[model samples]
Target: MNQLKGVVSHHEREIAELRADRELAVAYLKAAMESLDDPDERAAGLLALRTVAEAHGGLGAVAAEAGISRESLYRSLSPKGNPTLKTLLAVLKTMGMRLSVEPEHQAHA
Candidate 1:
């Protein structure tokens, strides 16, 4: 292995790692979902999900399993996209995960 320059870009390396690690995939998405709640970081959140989709499963396969067209999934997961709850659930389920609710930490007054 005699290489002077890195062959794969950082993003490609990240995607490869995510594909290999399901736990990592879940944690990454969990953090990303928080951003979805913030208006300013919504696009970044969507992009994060999109990246996981590309890693865990290709967009085409995920879309098919989720009962959506590939093109539609692409549009819905795009950076500017605002996905419906159904779409979000479908995507998560397709990725072998599900969303859950937990009590947020709040100070009792």
Candidate 2:
């Protein structure tokens, strides 16, 4: 049981490090947002932002870059958070990324 916990912790640490990369972080954020129509997935996207913030430079630094209070960022990024578009754009900008739109594929009805 202890070993399993250690392994999980180790993997989490690795993921945090990976999230620090700009490319990977962008991809992760995009994937999360793309799945946001589902409530559960939306929560997961918000959670992913928290992880990315931590990876980039912890919540404090990310919040500072986004010109928002750390507390607000924390609350807005929480699992049940509903951050506004402004907040989301600011955070993405702080991370040196931007939001882009792509047409969703559809089949003829």
Candidate 3:
């Protein structure tokens, strides 16, 4: 049990550190979001956002920057969360990111 706990803690720290690199974090999250057709990918994307938030300053700081309560931020970032566009955009903005769209294919149908 202690070994498992240690492993979890170690991984959490690694994720926190990995998110320190904005480019990597953005790329990772963008890739995750790009796979939205898969349920697991959606969950992974949300979790990635949570991890990035943790790296930036944890939920409390993110919530403060986004002008939302910490609990709300946590709930919004949870696996089952379906945050509104406003909430999503606000959180992303606080993280120094914005949503962008590009053609899915080089040639249009």
Candidate 4:
């Protein structure tokens, strides 16, 4: 009984760590989306989205959550994928996130 209890406790700790890591991934993806402004943003966002999707299970799982076809999610979030606003929003929403716009910094005269 003591050994069983120890095993359960270890598993619980592992699960908690996984949850924290997943939350970090989600936060990083949100930050990446907010930082988009140049070609780099697209690249970074795609990578971040892919990482989050993989963590949640993969393209198929993410597609299901986003209410899109698996193939569509794969194509859109690929490194070369140019996702539409609708697709982007859907994926973010499925990940418990939303997009926000902030004012750009003023350029020097």
Query: What does candidate 1's lDDT look like per residue over 1-109, in tens digits?
Result: 7876758977788889999999999999999988887899999899889999999768899999999999988999898898899999999999999998867668989
The segments of candidate 3 whose C-alpha lies over 4 angstroms from its true place after superposition are 1-10, 106-109
lDDT-wise, the better of 2 and 4 is 2
Pairs with steric clashes in candidate 1: none
Off by over 4 Å in 4: 1-19, 106-109
What are the Cα lDDT values of the candidates? 0.90, 0.82, 0.79, 0.72
Q: For residues 1-109, write the lDDT of model 2, one tens digit per residue.
A: 3354345575477457556566887787778887676886888889887887778878899999899999999999998898888999999888887888888878989
- Using all chains and alpha carbons, the TM-scores for the candidates as numbered come to 0.87, 0.81, 0.79, 0.68
Per-residue lDDT of 1-109 in model 3, one digit per residue for the tens? 3354345576576576666677888887688677654776677678778888888778899999998999998888888877778888988899888999977856757
Best by TM-score: 1
Residue-level lDDT of model 4, residues 47-69, one tens digit each, is: 66766766656668778988899
Worst 10 residues of 1 by lDDT: 1-10
After best superposition, candidate 4 residue 75: deviation in angstroms?
Answer: 0.9
Q: Which numbered prediction scores highest in lDDT against the true structure? A: 1
Q: Write down the RMSD of candidate 3 (Cα, Å).
A: 3.0
Cα misplacement distance, residue 18 of candidate 4 (Å): 7.3
Off by over 4 Å in 1: 1-6, 105-109
Relative to the unseen true structure, what is the C-alpha lDDT of residue 11 in candidate 4, on a scale of 0 to 100?
36
Ranking by TM-score: 1, 2, 3, 4
lDDT score of residue 24 within candidate 4: 76
